[model samples]
Each structure stands twice: as structure tokens, then as C-alpha cells.
Target: MLSVESLSKSYGKKEIFKDISFSVQPGNIIGLVGENGAGKSTLLSILATLQSPEKGSIALFELDYKSKKREVRKHIAFVPQDIALWEDLTVEENMMFFEKLSWKKKGKEELKQLCSNVKLDRWNERVKTLSGGMKRKLNLAVSLIHDPELLLLDEPTAGIDLKSRKEIGNYLKKLALENGKMIIYTSHDMDEITNLCDQIICIGEDPFYQEILTETGKNILSF
Candidate 1:
């Protein structure tokens, strides 16, 4: 559902990615890996339409990103590494706010169901009162209010407890396998990469590596 061609980015003399190209199809989970300061987040930001690359082209389902960002954004949801919640708002309030922003207007039951899916069960709890893991789950749930076709999660499971991490992993797997969402998430954990992704892509340097991690009973998403 996505194609990137010869993407390059730089800040003054320093460069990020150069000539990086890859494609991700529906039901595919792309695990992006690189060392710190490798521009993993930068790439995600470009894909999220928060920033434009110095040079390159991105196409989402054949729709050019540069010229069609508004249309492209409707089909994409981004969960960044940082917690993006109103500290004073109740969890349910946050969901409702984003729902309105997306103009999806999902009903209470559906929103709660999404929260349940992400293990954010306390609807009336304020954001500042939640644990780190719960906050991450809430961040994830907010992004899914519109059910975008492509999901970009930056360090989704980072800093969470083991149980919460596992919960996030299973939920993401279900999103790709059952709902056919194309997911690209960054992680420092190779185990998470092997367990969750259909492919592993290592960025931040030349000779970009994209390798299929498994061919077991997985439902491969054809490009």
C-alpha cells in the first residue's frame, strides 16, 4: 500500500537517508531498525506528512504523497515515540477529541472497544494519572479512531512493562492479520521484530536492508 523511491533527507551538511526505497503492502508489518540518531523518526515523520524529504517520492496506494497529502493522511495513522495526550483530560475525553478531529464520530461503544483492544480500560481516568504503559496504549488507541489503512508506530512498546509490551504486540499482530492494516513500527528489540513483522528493514545507511523474516503459516501480503 506504500512505495518510497530514492528518498533523501539532510540538515545542512549532515545527511539522514539517501536513495532509500521500499514498499509495504497490506497486511504487512515492517519492522524498522537502526542505531540511535539514524533518522528512523525522521523517516516516519516524512511518511506521516509532518516533514518533507529533501528529495524523493512517496506514493500511498498509488497516490503521490507530496501533492495528495490530505487524501493520503486520511488513510494513515501515526503513533509517535513521545506521549501525545492532554495531561488534564480524561482518557475518554481524549478519544472523543481525536474522533471529532478525524471527523469519524465513532460511537461510545466502538471507542471503548478500541480502548479495550489497546488495554486502556479506564475510561474516566485522567491522562496524568495513568502509568507509562497505559499512556502508550492510550496514544495508540487515539491514533486508531479513524481506522486508517496504514499504521506508523514509533517505539510503540518502548519503556512499557513486559505484560503491557506483550499486549501491544498481540494487538498489533491482530491489526495486520485480521484487519489488513499495513503497519510500520520502529523498535530496538530484535525479538519484537522477528515476532511481529513480515519483514525487517534496517535504515540509516547505504545498502538499505529489507529482509523477509519468516515464511511460516503467515499470510503474506502481496505487493
Candidate 2:
């Protein structure tokens, strides 16, 4: 489980979010929605342990972010808004590079399977040669190289075609339901949000922080 309580952050005199709280259970696909300056990316960055929160606490699987930063990171993966890859490298090379950086290394077969999961079969094709959607898919595949339990994505489907978007959405759903991985992603597509997310967390601009269940007759949590 993921527990966030009274979370707050600020930049100098500017406050981003204050007293934000929520919890996510296993196998839940959460959609984080807000305006441009709503701090969606900021929140994800904090959760990913890339930045420290000025106040509040975050715990994943009972591990506190402050005291167990390294351990927590082992089970967490963050896919940033911008694709992080070596454009000059091939698909397999990129995967190998990220795998080497991970704490837990995966075998060649395992790495190949990860690529297959995203349908990225062009092992020798350079990242620069792949299309936008393929690159996004490859980005996701690389993030999963460590087999993290929690996945954080930022506009993963942005600039992708309908088919590619659907493929990525399907793969995410599979990972959550079949693999029991927790997913939190930020997106502007309502249709995608409605179709992929089990719950929606609205932040920034919105006076009341809320978590709305996408499923009918489900309970809604608001603060």
C-alpha cells in the first residue's frame, strides 16, 4: 500500500501543495489530473524520491520515504514526461544500459521479454529510428527492467497514435491487474483517464483535494 499524509511542498515563497493526503492499494491504476501549474509532476517527483517534501510523509509498503529511501526506490520506477534514452543507441543497447544501472540486474531473456511486453521487437533499431509511440513504449520497458512494484508515468501516451495509446494502456492494465503492480500516471486525455484509471486524484486549482472512483457505486474520498 502507498500512504501519503499531510504532504506539502514549496519553492521559496511559492507554495505548491499543502496537506495533501491519499492512499493507493495494490493493483490500482490512479490518474492524477490538474491544470498546467497544478504540481502534478512535482508530486510524482516527490513520490519517486527524486525530491524531498518540505513537510508531510510518504510510505510505500510500510517503508517510510525518509528513513528507507534506497530500499523504497528498489520497488519503485518513474517514467518521466520527457523520454530518457540515448537516441544514438539501439533498443537492446538502451535496455542493457538501464539494466546495468538498476540495483537488480535482469538476464538477457528477461530483458528481451520486457521489450516484448511493449511489442518493441526491433532489438537492433536505434532509438532515433523508432517512432514517438515506439520510443514511449521503449521508455516504459526500460523503467520496468528492475521489476518495480510501483510505476509512475507522466503523460506516457502523449503524441502517440490511437493504436499505440491503446497498446500502452492495455499493457498498463495488464501490469496492474495481472502483475499486481500499482500505477499512478498523469494525463490530459479524459477518454484515456476514464478508460484506464480506477480512481482519479484532482489537485492544484481545485479547492478540495479529491479521489473519485471511476467505477460506478464506488466510494469517493475527499479532503
Candidate 3:
């Protein structure tokens, strides 16, 4: 489980968010939704342990963020809004490079399987030569090399075709239900969010609200 309490951040005198709190369970996908400049990306960065919050605390499976940052990172993977890959490298090459960088490296065959899981079959194709959808798929595949328990994605399917978006959405469901991976994703697509997430955390909205949705219905609570 992931727990966040009283989280807050600020840049100089401008405050981003404050007193934010939420928890994520295994086998659940939490959609972090908000309008532009709502600190969605900034919050993800803090959860990824790449940035520090001015207040509050975060923990994963009871491991405190301040005291066990490295351990926390090991169990989570962060995929940013921007693609993080070498455009010049082939699909297979990119997989191998990321694998080698992981603390738990896998064999070439295993690395290839990771890509296969995401349906990225263009092994020899350079990232620069692949379509936007294919590139997005490869980006996701690369992040699975370490097999983290949690995935943090920021607009992962943004600017992609419907087919690609559907494929990514389906795979994320598989990861959560079949593999028990916790996910926190951000997207502007309401249909995708409604279909993909088990709950919604809305930040930076007036009279702050967090809506928890299930198959039955949705409940809105003001914070």
C-alpha cells in the first residue's frame, strides 16, 4: 500500500498544493486528475522521490519516505510526460540499455519479453523511425525492466491514436489486476479515466474535491 498525508509544496511564495492526502491499495489504479498547473506532475515527482515536499509524509508498505527513500524508489517506477529514451537507439537496444542500468539486470531474452508484454514487436526499429504510438509503447516497456510494484505515469497516452490508447489502457489493467501492481496515472481524457481508474484524486480545484468511484457509483468529498 501507498500512503500520503498532509502533503504540500511551494515554489518561493507561490503555493502549489497543501494538506493533500490519499492511499493506494494493491491491484488498484488511482487516477490523479486536475487542470493545467494543478501540480499533478509536481506531486508525481514528489511521490517518485525525485523531489521533496515541504510538509507531510509518504510511505510504501510502512517504509517511511524520509528514512527509506532508496527502498521506496526500488518498489516504484516513474514514467514522465516526456518520452525518456534514446531516439537513435533501436527498440531492442533501448531495452538492453535500460536493463543494464537496473540493479536487477535481466538476460537479453527476458528484456525482449518485457517489450513483448507491451506488444512492441519492432525490435530492430529505431525510436526515431517508429510512430508516436509505437514510441509510447516502447517507453512503457522500458520502465518495466526492474519490475516495480508501483507505476507512476504522467499523460502516458497523450497525443496518441485511439488504438494505441486502448492498448495501453488494457495493459495497465492487466498489470493491476493480474500482477497486483499499484498505479497512479494522470490524463486529461475523461473517458479513459472513467474506464481505467478505480478512484479519482482531483487536485487544485476550487473547494478541493476527491471522488472515489467504483462499479456502483461515485462519491464526492470536499477537502
Q: Estimate each model's TM-score.
A: 0.91, 0.92, 0.93
lDDT of 3 by residue, 127-222 (tens): 999999999999898888899998999899999999999999999999999999999998988779888888777777654233323332543222
Best by TM-score: 3
Q: What lDDT, from 0 to 1, does candidate 2 have?
A: 0.88
Candidate 2, poorest ten consecutive residues by summed lDDT: 209-218
Whole-model lDDT for model 1 versus the true structure?
Answer: 0.86
Worst 10 residues of 1 by lDDT: 207-216
- Clashes in model 3: which pairs? none
Clash pairs, candidate 2, are none
Q: Report lDDT per candidate.
A: 0.86, 0.88, 0.87
